[model samples]
Target: MALMTTRPWKHPKTGIYYLRRAVPADLLARVGKREEKISLGTKDPVRAKGLHASALLELEQRWANLRCGAASLSEREAHELAAPLSAWWFDQHRDEPSQQTFWRTDLGDGLWPRRPPGWSLRPAVGAALIEEAADSSVHARCAMEDWCSEQADALLKRRGLVVDETDRRKLARAVAAVMQRASLALHAAMRGEAVDVGQTLVVRPAMPTSAMATPPAEMAQNSLLPISLTALVEAWWREAERTGKAASTHEAYAHAFRLLVAFLGHDNAHRVTKHDIVRFKDHRLASRKRNGDLVSATTVKNSDLAALKAVFGWALDNGRIIENPALGVTVAKAAKVKLREREFTAEEARTLLRAASDLTPGRELPQTYAAKHWIPWVLAFTGARVGEIAQLRRQDLRRETVAGYPEGVWVLRITPEAGTVKTKQAREVPLHPQLVELGFPAFVEGGRGERLFIVPDVKGQIAGPLQGVKNRLSEFARHHVIDPGVSPNHSWRHRFRTVATEAGVSGNVIDALCGWSAKSVGERYGSVSLKARTDAIMRLPRIEV
Candidate 1:
């Protein structure tokens, strides 16, 4: 008898190799199948092996997408995918452009010296109304920004549709392309090469050559728009919130924008061009901090320039502006100040855990010590982040029966409901026996609060409690754990990783327990059972002061 294998299973009738792997029982409910099969399209053993690997990867990705609530394209989505391509094609062959140029009689749309082939192929739009619009002088008199907006409005009316920012750019680009060729016709007409077509009177371009100077009156007209820098920042913030961006991201953008508004006068976004932004960038690079102190170039990039990029990019894409002022601007990457990884020594970890076990509540410790005490211990043992441990709720502590495990497991569910996870993936970290032995489970069982940790908050406010806990933890670390090399609460996580690795735990298991995705293809197929994680965790030496 041969050992059963789940490689490429060959069909008896067709002699074609088909990759066959039994889908995990847990995923079967969501996947709606017990097993997944993909034809390898080959009978050769080596070729089948290669094909099987590729097919299996795609299947796994599909399953992952399913778990993440991303489904295959719907009817509307599939059409949208093809819509851009078809629209691009339509603009490529739009025949009414030369006709419009005939009506314009202006160099901007007139026949050009360097016009691409098929310049004359555009079918003339005989509709006098469209021709009247094409020849409208209202835009040519206005500022370029207003002209562009008017043109966009005209485009929408012409197409009988409203479009998103993506389509607006496409139309803008197409309009510019048409204008380029037509502008050349001005040169042709000036050089006495103007051709006579029916109803086409050669029009001259308004823009003058070197010999011709623009009028002083036209130059004196103000280009300053009334839309302020504050407006753009506010809109970006609203969009960020609407799109479900993380709270921390909103805070960072807010801080940076405040610095920009303060320094740059919070004037009109339209009034600020590339030149204005360059000054702001230069000022920061030369150590003009918002606090008026010298900071590194890296700080400028992370805060000021990066925030502007997000703001200007959003404004451009949302059709709030014709172009992004911050498009090509950047603070060049500079060498960063190197800092050591914060990790406590083994002995220090033991001491910290012991002190957290102090049951006495005082002015310094308070009643919240129940949670504050366990936070460091949990982080030290689990290597979970401070943010993750601090945000745990009463319901998150679980002892549940899992499939394939004879005995149930005690696991802490770290998720986003109470607070945010850095990776966004919720993971189960098996509770260490040492923590259980230290009455951690009993403490949790006794808790009646909605939150695992108690932090002060103001009504209708979100950041108060979270920020409070973090500040308190930092103070605790500074006072108790006096190490120049290690940070307080965060050092506990680093120490856990250090000890876990030293104790010969596999990297993947540690990553799994810490809410990290698999780094390898094969690792994706198998489950990291609670028993395996529990066993691996038990391998660590118990902390002792």
Candidate 2:
């Protein structure tokens, strides 16, 4: 008899565990699903069990909250109820006095100091002046009144709390007061003076080393050390080992943390807070690149904010910290300005195809031979990302039988076995007749090497060499196409989508061919078979270059 165990269901292909639950009959229509298969994202059975329980509880809470409907609170109740948040804010900012700025606002007659446009205030004073300001000045504050107004919604969402517009305003004002008190205390500390901002301003004493549950020796070797930046990042990287994420992803996250440490002049991640992150963001935005342009908001959001959220979220889930400080912090991207069409024009596509097809063999590096001669055609026909084609292996191409086709279709399997696939799901793209006519099968059979394009490392990871070949391919394409708006390689993706749709290909078939994620729950129910993909592949019109 098989051993009986209570464990999360393991995925056959990915080997990751999932929390599989059937939806309650009444909720089926509401959720638009009869079942929920949430990924635990871990291969370890022990870790999967813990993650499964937490995920199930969270799902249950969400359903409960949905059934309960929106709850309301009085404005006074909202304001008074924000006391704990105020205390938490104080605790985060109390020791960081130098990070605060004090502005003078007159309460009498409501007339503030009149200053020139864009004028900034700077003061060089000791404890005496700061204390005098705290005592005599009407309100020692920063721009938190306006800041809180903007952040109120996100703040409420982070705490899983909700409020009406009337109550939200009251809550913002209460938060503003809390921030002002902390700012006052910070200002005082800047000048070597201490100011009392009531009971909430109290900082907790550190626990004695001897009294801690975990011994120092064990804590020293713990990869989940909350205070050590390196430890935290390493822990996240280890957890992501089997996640099908790119190696460059780990490097980017590690680099983001390094940048943070350099800016803050410390590696103690536990000491970092939201205010520090805000300050760093402001500094980053104010700085410029080598081209003398301000860093784009999208870059900061994707790189820094994304890194912080991932690492801190991992730390919190593993019980390294009580909360993720990066939560509720975000940079809004500016509206994109249109220049030209993103997709390549017919003439541009023809130019690239003709150039790629005309490339003489044995002239360039042996590794980039496939990238130059074949990858462009592959991308043009399939709409797969350049990386996906660039990382393809010679063995990935095979002939598989289909229901309608007697001879079967030649399929190119885009699998993580080649490298990191974006969706972490293997997909079979049928070779377009145009590609087979161009002798793609002969090219695959002719190669003695393992990979069709780039070389892999000792550990069989192709991320590093994969990037190099991709760059070389882009450089080759850039020589033929000179559009500023259209990417050298990515334009193929856009162009293929247009050509495929124009050829009467189904959206779901196109998604399967290109590895694009399904847009709806209903779309995820069934698999897009090889027969369907072959039919769609035949529909794609050949580029007459």
TM-score of each: 0.51, 0.56
Model 2 agreement with the true structure over 437-468: per-residue lDDT tens digits: 99988888888788888878788778778878
Best by lDDT: 2
lDDT of each: 0.59, 0.69
For this target, which candidate reaches the highest TM-score against the unseen true structure? 2
**Cα misplacement distance, residue 439 of candidate 2 (Å):** 2.8
Error of 2 at 294 (Å): 6.5
Q: lDDT score of model 1?
A: 0.59
Against the true structure, candidate 2 reaches a TM-score of 0.56
Q: Give me the runs in candidate 1 sitting further than 4 Å from their true place.
A: 1-234, 237-244, 262-300, 322-342, 358-371, 402-408, 454-461, 480-487
lDDT of 1 at 506: 89
Cα error, residue 482 of model 1, in Å, equals: 5.2
Span of 10 residues, lowest total lDDT, candidate 2: 205-214
